[model samples]
Target: MLKRVLLLLLSLMLITTLLVGCGGGTTEPETPEETPEATQPEAEETAAIKMAMVTDVGGVNDQSFNQSAWEGHQKARNELGVEVNYVESNQDADYLPNLEQLYDAGYDLIWGIGFMMGDVILEAAEQNPDQKYAIIDNAYGDTPSNLVGVLFKAEEASFLVGYIAGKMTETGKVGFVGGMDFPVIHGFHYGFMAGVKHANPDVEVLVQYAGDFNDAAIGKAIAIQMYQSGADIVFHAAGGTGDGVIEAAREQGKYAIGVDRDQNDLAPDNVITSAMKRVDNAIFNIAEELKAGNFPGGGTVVYGLEDGGVGIAPTSDKHVPADILEETRAIEQQIIRGEIFVPDNEADYNANY
Candidate 1:
């Protein structure tokens, strides 16, 4: 009877254990199965640097200085993996606002595309001491620590084209159209005059200033008048206004020389050659230097024939004779070797001539 009682008590304990295992008590959620930590994604790459430019009144499509500079910025973006952009200035009044727009966006570097913006760029640099700035065609007497001046020997390039004009003119009379009476224009005019005289002392060069760089009509009118007056070739340093000069040449069946860029495409048959001021190279090199952590600021970088900064366009071979091109190259070497000194101003031009 005691053994039976013991068996019955053991069976009752087993039944209670079975009931507890089946779900008679609260669940503890299985400790959430020891969940693993979440994985993270990789970080993205950023641009090496950011650069922006404020174009002059000529705008980026001027097919001249502004256009060339924009090309440089594009090349920097493509080749160096840098961020690049530009804002056009429709008029002189737009320069400040355009620069301010780029400044507010916090660009690593800012560029003023013309000498006309010298005063304003300098003022902006002084106001924002930490920001970097650069300008083309202008240099300050005392540069700020954050500013760089990129100057080209326009006279050198102008002289080469002027020599072409003098040598190629069938009427023995070539013409010059200037944007303004400013020093930069003076460089173009005086250098051209010197080159013309150097090439052919007897060839007459008529001069006119549109007093505007954006007026194609004014340039066309001036060029037409000059063409009618017996000039067979015309060279212009009048920015976008030079486009009209080339147009007039096409219409009148005369020759035109472009400035700041290779403008042969503008009037393939009419445009004989161009004066190339390597604004694109200047801009690209500066961006490259900045990317390499060697920003050259607080100084002026002068680009000349020796450094391949300024010269006649490569398309000269298409129109100019091989002998002429050879002679031009010889003269180029003379200038580079310091055997020939091209005058850039009125007084020097007059004194030397």
Candidate 2:
């Protein structure tokens, strides 16, 4: 009976040791831990709309209309998330090739920045048939479905400054330096002359053409002769060549009139004021329209005094008299109101005269 009792006690002790070894000694559970959230990837940015601008032989940095147009496109690129590119034309022959290459690169829009580019852009537009184009300083006939012509009434604006020149001239003489005798440049000459005559009918207006828009040396030489011949102020429509006209004015201690955009800052002492054609505004308008999916197309859109497309640049450091400034404003109003019929060409000038 004692041996059977001892065997029962030993079996109970062994079962207790097995239960402790199997983790039944403590009746407590282990504390649980929280898992962290998984990180998510970021989304990508949308692609930008691409556009290209082809500059005429005047080059993109002409510091005239070309530069203004480029600035407008560049603004669209920087502020509105559009892609813009420009190719310069070193020679007249380069227009076609430069435009064709950009078109082939699948640009959503293209621009040609001079009147001289009219034929080439028209040809390219005809060939592409589907691509959109905005042209500056040119109005085309038989318009394309995808093309818009940006034209400015530069003559009317030039006339306003021409009147200023006539009123301010100490010599009773003024001069005009033109890049070419083309209709556009000719219009500048005629309108300016008419304004001078209107202000001082006895004031003599001398005119010369540089025959090339890119030659500053020629423009300078022409301006020197005009100054020597008794002209006190010289107005230039000679693109990059006009830079020389400004230089000549500085050397002669005379004043100059600038074209295309406000150029009073070009030579503050020499440039009285500039005839602004709002090229920058025009280009920006087109770019904004395109980016907004409004293609502003077909036929020509003429920008004039009434449209805020043309005006005389504010006098900068030139200290234009208050009377002259007021008179300029009045003349602008006259042109807008049809009281002053500024002629655009020789025929118009003849008829009006």
Candidate 3:
């Protein structure tokens, strides 16, 4: 009887050990199930929407509009979880090919950085009707359903800087150096001239066009001539060429108003203000719209002082007088409230003035 009791106890102990081993096997399988949950978010991130841009002739780092636009896409990547990239265009010939490269890569949205690319973007949009595209500084009478056009009230911003130039000039004159003589650039000229007139009609505005946006040497030469001729301040609407304008200001102890981006960093003491276009804001907004399924394709979207799309650099306070900033803000509100119409063209300028 004692032997039978000992054998029964040993059998019971063996059954308990087997049960614990079986439970451990079940938990091991559960770890793999939890692994997929840990990696699921990574999979979603890997499938994120891709966005890209093709730079204009000035390339991506022109320290101008192209750089601003690229910054916009980069901001989208950081805040919106979209992948972004850019391709440099050495000349007009590279526009279509560079765009095609991004397009072929299956980018969900592609951008052409300047008005010079209006035709190229249009061509790409027409060729790939299913693809979506956006262009800065250009608007078309007719465009395909997949394209978006972006325009800024450049004149409004130009007017603000022009007012600053007019008020700050001690030499009784200011200057304007432009990249091209097209209507887009004309907006800058007309509005600036208007603002100078508004502030001091007797203050002369010396105007010149570099005819090329890439040559900093020519821009510097033009600005130097204007300064030598008794102009104390200069404003530039040129692209990379505008860098020369700021350089001349720094070297000549004069002030320069920059364009497209906040160029105060180029020459902190020399660049008093800039006609801020908010291209980065525009591009980021478009990306947000796309992510929200509300993209404004096949149409034009205009940005201006009213919508905070265009304005002067925040750094103006360091170089601009408190009274001038106060007055400029007042004029900004006037434009926003429709009490003032900043002209953007030759006829409108003449009519308004």
Clash totals for all models, in order? 0, 0, 0
Residue 171 CA error for candidate 2 (Å)?
A: 0.9
Better lDDT candidate (1, 2): 1
Q: Which stretches of candidate 2 lie above 4 Å from their native place?
A: 1-46
Residue-level lDDT tens digits of model 1 in 249-280? 99999999999999999999999999899999
Per-residue CA lDDT of model 2 for 233-344, tens digit only, reads 9999999999999999999998899988888778888898888889888887777878788887888888899989998886633557888888888888889999989998
Model 3: weakest 10-residue lDDT segment is 30-39
Q: Which candidate do you rate higher for TM-score, 2 or 3?
A: 3
How do the candidates rank by lDDT, highest first?
3, 1, 2
Q: Tell me which residue pairs clash in candidate 2.
A: none
**Measured by TM-score, how close is model 3 to the native structure?**
0.87
lDDT of 2 at 304: 92
Model 1 local distance difference test score: 0.92
